[model samples]
Target: MAVTRSLSTLIFDLGNVVITWDPRPALPEQYTGQDAEDLLTRLDFFTRNADHDAGKPFAEWVADLRSSGDAEGADALQHYVDHFDRSLVGLVRGTSQLIDDLKAAGVTLYALTNWSAETFHHAQAAAPALAQFDDILVSGEEGIAKPNPEIYTRALERWDLDVRTTGFLDDSEANIAGAESVGLTTHLFTNAVDARAWARDMTGAAGV
Candidate 1:
């Protein structure tokens, strides 16, 4: 018979998994529908945002846009910075309860997230449940984003966690793959209910 190791520690991904992020609301009212889609395309939003998550300052990005004769894009980016709080829609449904239950059960908890250092405060302010984590590792702060094996290794080393006993929960398939590469048990989170079941099985925590 094979025996399974119980997960004593859990590393959670904040975006989507804990906090819901929707940039649409952050745009000016005029940039609605196709205008919004076009604006994002013009600015290469996702790629540039990834650079921000990897520690590139927003000012630098805005400057680059301005220099490229993209004043509109630059202003929009600034607006996003000024009103970043609006982008954090809310907490993922049922995650706060799960976090509370896990904490009550004495499971060590930590957070690993890909987020801009300049704007992470918005998420912090919006999600009170985030305070439950023992620690949080932000990609922007570390200058290393997810899907990078080094960050996962750093998380393990920083927390003195045994990979075999730690489980990682993330919404990104790439991030989950990275955690698996590091030999940590992983759950690709879709919703809190499924996550609760996985947590219960891994931790044997009652009422998870």
Candidate 2:
């Protein structure tokens, strides 16, 4: 395919978009050389909750879950730290060639993700290319999350993007629908390869 249609901007989700985000690899390391098999079996640390990520602090999240009967075997006071220590390793992923490719095309790029301020800050080192974007919008700071219409609106608002000329890529169905609800094009990202193909397909831009 050749570059045919032009777009005002391209927005991307962070987790599985430009980064390799699989916590399974790092889970065992969490319990390695320990009595526990892995943290997954002992703790329900699968996904990030939007509410806690919005304005509530991480300490509040730890307290809420701790009160839910998920007792910490070690020092209860240190549970949050331990959890973050082992779990945060899941955030790192190398530079996405697809993003680089898009930037090379002189396309306006932006990061619209539901991430806490601290976590997103740490991500700065993990994914430096993220800074290359024209803009980055995180839900924690925005005080909203997808599929909430507000967050998407906030993104569009930041860029002064025309819904008709913008496209979004995310891993969640709800988020994609939310984007489409607001008049922007959406792609359900299955993997980096799939995302790259769909991006090209959507904008009628040829693959790199």
Candidate 3:
């Protein structure tokens, strides 16, 4: 059965949902070929990258990597810093249009994302479409990330939104579970196409 409700508030997750961010594309020229692959495998970029989302300072992270005798990892992290904007390829196709449609339908849009405080500005500059959101909550700024219930509560309470009527979209299952735990109508995102469809259905913005 489709659980129907008047979902007035629509919340979006930034990474992958709105913009493309694949760190592998940012590999430095010096680290190309086998060296790049080996360094990525050794550093576990995605796993350790979460530390940045958790408010870890870039300088501190690089220091730790260097101290741990992973100079290659440190260099890779520097490369990411140098190519921060490039790392985020561009906007997720169709999402900008979806935002416009949702707005036309009188649905309020907000963003709850686990993006690093230091790097978020670059994303904003790279993808001006993000500016369409009425409000945006950054986990790094709040010292908390998704999958942690506190951040969800903060976003909900900040807008004085009733969890039952608020719809939250995220690509991570764990983050979806976290939103559900807080009583939000959660959508587990697979791609922008499906995500836009679900938003339209929930907000009745299909024709708008």
| The candidate that achieves the highest lDDT relative to the unseen native structure | 1
Which residue pairs collide in model 1, if any? none
Q: Rank the candidates by lDDT, best first.
A: 1, 3, 2
Backbone clashes, each candidate: 0, 0, 0
How well does each candidate superpose onto the true structure, as a TM-score? 0.97, 0.77, 0.93
Summing lDDT over every window of 10 consecutive residues in candidate 2, give the lowest-scoring window. 73-82
**Model 2 residue 180 distance off true place after TM-score fit, in angstroms:** 1.0
Number of the candidate with higher TM-score, 1 or 2: 1
Q: Candidate 3 on 1-208: residue-level lDDT in tens?
A: 9768779899999898888887767877777778877877888777777778878888887898899998977887888877888789888887778877788788899999998898889878877777889889998788888989999999998989988789999889999999999899988988778877787778786574
Determine the C-alpha RMSD for candidate 3 after optimal superposition of all C-alphas. Answer: 1.6
Question: What ranges in model 2 sit over 4 Å off?
Answer: 1-6, 22-48, 65-95, 204-207
CA shift of 89, model 1, Å: 0.7
CA lDDT, every model vs. true structure: 0.93, 0.68, 0.85
Report the candidate with higher TM-score, 1 versus 3. Answer: 1
lDDT of 1 by residue, 1-55 (tens): 7566699999999999999998878988789899989999989999889999989
> What does the lDDT come to for candidate 3?
0.85
